[model samples]
Target: MQAAILRDKSGSLKIEEIEIDKPDRNEVLIQTVASGLCHSDLHFIDGSWSDFAMYPMLLGHEAAGVVQAVGEDVVGIEVGDHVITCLSIFCGHCDRCLTGHSYLCSHRQEVSDRPIGKPPRLIDGEGNAVNQFTGLGSFAQEMLVHQNGVVKISPDMPLDRAALIGCGVTTGVGAVFRTAEVKPGSTVAVVGCGGVGISAVQGAHLAGARQIIAVDLESQKLEWATQLGATHTVNPNDGDPVMQVLELTGGGVDYSFECIGMKQTAEQAFGMIRQGGSATIIGMIPIGVNIEVPGTDLFLGAKRLQGSMMGSNNFKVDMPHLCELYLGGRLKLDEMVSRTISLDEINEGFEAMINGEVVRAVIDFGT
Candidate 1:
C-alpha cells in the first residue's frame, strides 16, 4: 500500500509503496477512509516533540475506516464495520482499565505493538522495519492495529466526519464532557479555536454552559468558534486574553480549557478560571518545558490545574456515544471539515494546518 513516511524531524513526508504484514491474532485490518490532520502529529513531524516516535514512522492517528479483515482472535468487531481508531490501546485486565481509566492503561506499550520477536507490521521496500506512530498510523491507505485500538461506530456516520471524533473531537469533547465535567449554566473559556478548540466550544455548549468564550488570535477561528457554540469570542490581538476574558465574564470563568499546548496559553487558562474553578490543559505541550503557576493561589484561591490526555477517553464507550451525537445533529461535525484532500496532498494539508488556514483538514484516501 502507498503510505506517507516521515524519515526525519521537520521534514516533508515521502510517499512510498510499503509492505504491510498480515494481521496478527489480535489485530484488525482497516481500509482507511479518512484521516484528520492533527496538531499533535505536527509536534512530532516538526520536531517540537519526539519521544516514542522513531524515524521512518507513519504519523497519523485521527482516522475512521471500514474494517477490511480481522484476525481469528479479534472479537466484537467484524469485517465491513465502520470504526474510529484511537491511540489509547488498552489491555482489558489492567488495573487502569478495570478502574475505568483505560486511557492510563498500564499495558499500553505491551499490547499496542507487535511482540519483540514478531516481524514488523510495516516495512520499506528494502525490507527495513518502519515504526507506526502511536500504533495506528492512519496516514496510510490502510491501518493494521490491535483490536483494542479501534471502536466500531454506526455505519451511518460519515467516515470523514467520524475521523475527527477519533482524536480532535474526542479530546475536545471529552475534556469538557468527561474530564472537567463542566456543569450546566457555568461559564467556560477555551483557548485556541482549531479543530479541537471548536470541539471544546461545542462540548461546553452541549454541557449547557451559560457562556462559552472562545479565544484565538485569528478572527476566522473566532468566527468559526461562535458558529459552533462559543457565545462570545476573544482575539488576543485586542489585549491580554486573560484580562479580556475576565472583563467579559465579570471576574473569571468557571472552567477554562487550554488547547494550544503553549506555556503562555496554559498559564492564561489558569488565570482565566475563578477561585475553586478548574483549568484543564488538553494540548500536547513540548516535553521538558516546565509550566510555572502562582504558588500562593493554590493556598488562597483553591484553583486547580490538571492535564487531560485524549480527554481521558475510554474509546470503545466514548466513541460510539460521540458518533450518536454527531449522527443526531447535536454535535457539529459538518462545519468542522474545512477541506478534504487525497493522500498525495498530505504535505499541503499539514501546511494548511500550520498556517492556521483550516479547522480540520481530512485526507480522504479514497479520493
Candidate 2:
C-alpha cells in the first residue's frame, strides 16, 4: 500500500509504498474509502505537537471505509460493513470507560511495536518500523485497526460524508451536546468557522439555540456559518466582538465555544460568557501556553472553563447516532465537504486548509 508519510520535521508529506500488517484476533482490516485532511494532522506536520510522535509515521485519523476482513474475535461488525473510524478507541474496562468518559481512557493504546498477535504494521527502507498516527493511519488505501476504533454505520450514508463524523463533526457536535450541554433557547457563540467551527454552528442550531453567533476573521467563513445555521455572524476584525456579542445578547451568551485554539480567541470566548455561564475550549492549544483569567472576575461571575476532546465521544454509541442524524437531515454532514481530492493531491488540500480556504478537503481513498 502507498501512504502519505512524514519522515522529517518541516516539509510536505512524501508518498511511500509500504506493507500493511494483517489483522490480529481483535482487529479489523478496512479498505479505506474516504479520509479528511484535518488541522490536527497539520499540527504534527508543523511541529505544534512535537512531544508525542515518531518519525516516518503514517498520518491520518478521521476516516470511513468498508470492512475487507475481520479478525476471529471481532464481532458486531463483519465483512462488507461500512464504518467510520475514531481515534479515541477505548478499553471498555478502564476507569474512564466505566465512568462514561471513554474518550479519556488511559489504556486506549498498547505500547508495543506490533499489535498483540499481529505482525509489525510498517517498515522503512532500512527495515525501521514506524508508528501509526492516532493508531488509525487512514492516509493510505487500507488500514489495520482495533475493533474499538471503528463504528458500523448504515450503508445508505455516503462513506465520503461519513468520514467527517470521525473527527470534526464528532468534536463540534459532541461539544454542544455532550460537553457543554447547550440548552434550548440558550445563546451560543462559536469563535471559528473551519470544519469543526461550522459543525459547532450546526450543532448549536440543532440544539434549539435561539441565537447562534458565529465568529471568525474571514467573511467567507462567516457566510458559510450563516448557511449552516448561525442566526448571526461576527467578524472579530470588524470591531470588539465581545462588545458586539454583548450588544446582541443583552450581556453575554449562555455558552461560548472557542473553536480556534489561539490564546486570544480562547480569552475572547471566556469573556463572552454570561455570569454563571460555561465556556468550552474545543481547539487544540499549544503546550506551555498560559491562559490567564482574572481571579476576581471568576469568583464574582461563577463562570467555568472546560475542554472537550473528540466531543467526549463514545464511538460505539455516538458515531452511529450521528450517522442517523445525518441520514435524517438533522445533521448537515454533506455540506461540510468543500471538496474532495485523491491521494496524490493531498498536499494541495493541505495548502487550502492552511490558507483558510476550505471547510474540509476529503481524500477519496477509493480514487
Candidate 3:
C-alpha cells in the first residue's frame, strides 16, 4: 500500500510505498476510496502542534471507503460495507461512552491501538513501525482500524462526499446540532470560512437559523460562504470583525462558532455573542496558547465559552443521519469539495489549504 508519511515536523508529507497488516481481532480492513485533507493534519505538518506528533506516522483521519475484510470479533460490520472512519474511536464500556458522549471516550487508547509488543499495523520498507494517526491513517490506499471507529453508511451515498462527514462535516454540523443545540430562528455567526467553517455555515442554514454570518479575511471564502448559505459575510480586513458582527445582528448573535484556531478569532467569537448566548470553539488552538476573556462579562452576562471535540459526535448515528441529509438534497457536500486529487498530490493539497485556496481537497484513491 502507498501512504503519506510525515517523518518529522518539517512541514511536508512524503508519499512512499508501505505495508499494511491484515486486520486484527476487533479490527476492520478498508480499501480507501476517498479522504479529505483537514486542518488538524496541517497542525502537525506546520509544527503548530509538534509535541503530539509521532514521527514516521501515517497522517489522515477524515475518510470513507469499502470494507475489504473484518476481523472475527467484528460483529456489526462486514466485508463490502461502505463506511466512514472517525478519530473518536471509543470503548463501549467506558463511562463517557455509556453516558452518551462517546466522542469524549476516556478509554480510546485502550481499544484503538494494537497492544504494545504486537507487530505494528503499518511498516516501512526496512520493517520499522509507522504509527497510524488517530488510528485511521486514511491518506493511504488501505486503512486498518478498530471496528468502533467506523460508521456504516448507505451505499447510495457518494464516497467522495461521504468522506467529508468522517470529520469536517461531522465536526461543523455536529457542533450546531449536538454540541450547541442551535435552535431554529436563532442568529448565528461562524468565524473562519474554511472547510469546517463553511460546513458550520451550512449547518446553521439547515438548522433554520434566520441569520447566518460568515467571517473571514479572504473575500473569496466569504463568497463561497454566501453561495452555500451565509445570510451575510464579514471580512476582518475592513474593520473589527466583532464589531461588524454586532452591528449586523443589532447587538450580538445568539450563538457563535470559532472555526479558526487562533486566540484572536476565538476571543472575537466570544465578543460576537449576546448575553446568555454560547460560543463554541471547534478549532484546535496550538498547545500552550491561552485565550483570555473578561471574568465580569462571563459572570454578569451569563455568556458561555466552551470547546467542542469532533463536534461531540456519536458517529454511529450522526454520520448516517448526515448521509441521509446529503442524499435528500438538503445538506450540500458537493459544494464543499473544491478539488479532488490523487494521493501523490497530498502535499500540494495541504499547501492549498494553508493558503486558503480551497474549501476541501480530497484524495481519490480509486479503489
Candidate 4:
C-alpha cells in the first residue's frame, strides 16, 4: 500500500509505496476510506514534538474506514463493518480502564504494538520498520490496528465526515461532554478556531451553553466559528482577547477551553474563566513547554486548570453516540470538513493546516 512517511523532522511527508502486514492476533485490518489531517500530525512534522518523533513514521490517526479483515481473536467487529480509529487504545484489565477513565489507560502500550520480536505491521520496500503514529496510520490506504483502538459506527454515516469524529470531533466534543461535563446554560469560551477548536465551539453549542465565544488570531477562522455555533468571535489581533472575553461575559465565562497548544493561549483560557470555573487545555502544547497560571487565583478564587487527552474518550461508547448525533442532524460534521484531498496531496493538506487555510482537509483514499 502507498503511505505517507515522515522520514525525518524535515517538515514534509513523502508519499511512498510501503508494505502493510495482515492483521495479527487481536488486530483488525481496515481499508482506510477517509482520514483527517490533524494538527497533532503537524506537531511531529514541524519538530514541535521532537521527543516523540520516530523516523519513517506513518503520520495520521484521525480516520474512519471499512473493516477488511480481522484476526481470529477479534469479536464484535467483523469484515465490512464501518469504524473509526482512536488513539486511546486500552487494555480492558488496566486500572484506569476499570475505573471509567479508559482514555488514560496505563496499559495502552501493551495493546498498541505487536511483541518486540514479531515483524512490524508496516515496513519499507527495503524491509525497514515504519512506525504507525499512535498505532493507527490512517494516512495510508490501509490501517492495521489493535481491535481495542477501533469503534464500530453506523454504516449509514458518511465516511468522510465520520473520519473527523475519529479524533478532532471526539477530542473537542468529548472535552465538553465528558472531561468538563459542561453544563447547559453555562457561558463558554474556546481559544482557537482550527479543526479541534471549531469542534470545541460546536461542542459548547451542543452542550447548550448560553454564550459561546470563539477566540483566534484569524478573522476567517472566527467567521467559521460563528457559522458553526459560536455566539461571538474574538480575534486577538483586534485587542486583548482575554479582556474582550471577560467584558463580553461580564467578568468571566463558566468554562474555557484552550484548543491552541500555546503557553500564551493556555494561560489566556485560564484568565477567561469565572472564579469557580474550570479551564480545559485540549491542545498538545509542545513537549518541555510549561504553562504558568496565577497561583493565588487558583486557590483563592477556586479556579481549576487541567488538561484533557483525546477528550478523555471511551471510544467504544463515545464514537457510536457521536455518529448518532451526526446522523440525527445535531452534530455538524459536514461543516467541519473544509475540503477533501486524495492521499497523494497529503503534504499540501498539511501546509494548509499550518497556514490556517482550512478547518480540516481530509484525505480520501478512494477505497
Candidate 5:
C-alpha cells in the first residue's frame, strides 16, 4: 500500500510504498476514504506534545471509510460496511470502559502491532517496523486497526462528511452536549472558529442557546460562524473579547469554550464566565504552559474551568448518534469542509489550517 510517511520532525512527508500485515482476530482492514487534517497533527509536526511517535510513522487519525475486511472474531461489522474511524479505541474490559468513561480507557490501543498477538501491521521494504499515529494512520490508502477504533455508520452518510465525525465534530459537539451541557436560552461564547470551533457554534445552536457569541481574529471565520448560528461575533483584534462578550450578553456568558489552544484565550474563556458559570477548554494547550488566574475570582465568583478531550466522547454511542444528527439536518457537517485535496497535497492542507484559511482540509481518497 502507498502511505504518506512522516519521516521526521520539520520534514516533508514522503509518499512511500509500504506493506500492511493481514488482520488478526479483533482487527479489521479499511479502505481509506477521507481524512481530516487536524491541528493536533500540526502539534506533532511542530513538536508540542512529544512522544515516541516513531520515525517514518504513518500520520492521520481522523478518518472514515469502508470496511475492506474483518478478522474472524470481529462481530457487528463486516466487509463493505461503511464506517468512521475513531482514534479513541477502547478495550471493553478496561476499568475506564466499565466505569462508563471508555473515552478515557487506559488500554485504548492495540498492545501489539499485529492483531491479538501477531506482528506489527506496517513495515518498510527492508522489513523495518514503522509506527501508526493514534493507532489509525488514515493518511494511508488502507489501514488495519482494532475493531474498537471504528464505528459503523449509515451508508447514506457521505464518507467525506463522516470523516469529521471522527474528531473535530465529535469534540466540539461533545463539549456542549456531554461536557458543559449547555441549556436552552443560555448565553455562550466560543473563542475559535476553526473546524472544532465552528462545530461548537452549531452545537450551541442545536442546544437552543439564545445568544451564541462567536469570537475570532478572522472576519471570514466569523462570517462562517454567523451562517452556522452565531447570534453575535467579535474580533479580538478590535478590542477585548471578554469585554465585548460581556457587553453583548450583559455581564459575561453562562458558558464559554476555548477552542484555540493558547494561554491568553484559555484565560479569557475562564475569566468571561458569569458567576457560577462554567468554562470549558476544548483546545490542546502546550504541555507545561501555565496561565495565571486570580484565586479570589475563582473563590468568590464560583466560576469553574474544565478541560474536554475529544469532547469526552464515547465514540461507539456518540458517533452513530452524530451521524443521525447530520442525516436529520440538525448538524452542519458538509459546510464544515472548506476544501478537499489529494494525499500528495497534505502539506498544503496543514499550511491552510495554520494560516486560518480553511475550517478543515480533507484528504479525499477516491476509490
Candidate 6:
C-alpha cells in the first residue's frame, strides 16, 4: 500500500509504497477510510514535538476506518465494523485503566508495538522497520493496530467526519465534558481557533455555557469559532486577550481552555479564569516548557491549573457517544471538515494546517 513516510525532523512526508504485516492475535487491520491531518501530526513533522515519534514513521492517529480483518484473539470487534482509532492505548489491568482513568494508563506502550522479538507491523519496500505513529498511523491506505486503540462506532456515521473524533474532537470536547465538567450557564473561554480549539468551542456550547468566548490572532478562525458555538470572539491583535476576556465576562469566565499550547497563551488562559474557576490546558505545549501562574492566586483564590490528555477519554464509550451526537446533528463535525484530499496530497494537507488555512483537512485514502 502507498503511505506517507517521514524519515527526519522538520521534513515533508514523502508518499511511497510501503509494506504492512498481517493481523496478529490482539490486532486488527483497518482499511483507512478517512484520516484528519491534526496539529499533533504537524508538531512532529515540523520538529516542535518529537517525544514519542520514531524516525521512518507513519505520522497520523486521528482517523476512522472500515475493519478489513481482525486477529483470532480480538473479541467484541469484528471485520466490517466502522471504527475510530485512538492513540490512548491501555492495558485493561493497569491501575489507571482499572480506576476508570484509562487515558493515564502506564502500560499503553505494550498495546501499540509488539514485544521485542516480534516482527514489526510496518516496513519500507526494502523491508526496513517503519514505526507506526501511536500505532494507528492512518496517513496510509491500511493500518494494523491493537483492539485497545479501535473504537467501534455506528456505521451510519460518516467516516470523514468520524475521523475528527479520534483526536481533536475527543481532546477538545472531552476537556469540556469530562475533565473540567463546566457547569451549564457558566461563562467559558477558549484560546486558539484551530480544529481542536473550535471543537472546544462546540464543547463549551454543548455544556450549555452562557458566554462562550473564542480568542485567536486570526479573524477568519475567530469567525469560524463563532459559527461553531462561541457567543463572542476576541482577536489578540486588538488588545490583550486576557483583558478582553475579563471585560466581556464581567470579571472573568467560569472556566478557560488553552488550546493553542503556547506558554504565553496557557498563562493567558489562566489569567482569564474567575477566582475559583479552573483552566484546562488541552494543547500539547512542547516538552520541558513550563507555564508559570500567579502563586498567591493558587492559595488565596483557590484557582486550578490542570492538563488534559486526549480529553481523558475512554474510547470505547466516548467515541460512540460522540458519533451519536454527530448523527443527531448536535456535534458540528460537518463544519469541521474544511477540505478533503487524497493520500498523495498529504503534504499539501499538512502545509495547509501550518498556514492555518483549514479547520480539519482529511485524507481520503480511497482517493
| Alpha-carbon lDDT, every model | 0.93, 0.89, 0.94, 0.92, 0.89, 0.91
**Candidate 1 residue lDDT tens string, 231-298:** 99999999999999999999899999999999999999999999899999999888878789998877
Candidate 2: list runs displaced more than 4 Å. Answer: 111-118
Deviation in Å, model 4, residue 186 alpha carbon = 0.6
Clashes of 3: 0
Task: Find the candidate with the highest lDDT and give its number.
Answer: 3
Candidate 3 residue spans exceeding 4 A from truth = none
TM-scores for candidates 1 onward, in order: 0.98, 0.97, 0.99, 0.99, 0.97, 0.98
Write candidate 3's Cα lDDT for 55-125 as tens digits.
89889999999999999999899999999999999999988999999999999998779989888999998
C-alpha positional error of residue 285 in candidate 5 after TM-score superposition, expressed in Å: 0.7
Model 3 accuracy (lDDT, Cα) = 0.94
114, model 2: CA deviation in Å?
Answer: 4.1
Instruction: Give the Å shift of residue 102 in candidate 4.
Output: 1.0
Show how many residue pairs clash in every candidate, following the order shown: 0, 0, 0, 0, 0, 0
Which scores better on TM-score, 4 or 5?
Answer: 4
Question: Which digits, one per residue and each the tens of the lDDT, describe model 2 over residues 1-367?
Answer: 8889988787578888888878888788999999999999988888788676688888998999999999899989999999998999877888888999989988877621344664567765667776789888888999888888889999998999999999999999999999999999999999999999998999999999999999999999999999999999988788999998989899999999999898989998999989998899999999988787777667899999989998988878988899899999999987789889999998889999999989999999764
Per-residue lDDT tens digits for candidate 4, residues 86-183, read 99999999889999999998988888988889999999988999999998888999999999999899989999999999999999999998989999
- Any runs in candidate 5 off by more than 4 Å, and if so which? 110-117
**Residue 4's C-alpha lDDT in candidate 6?**
92
The stretch of ten residues in a row with the least summed lDDT in candidate 4 is 47-56
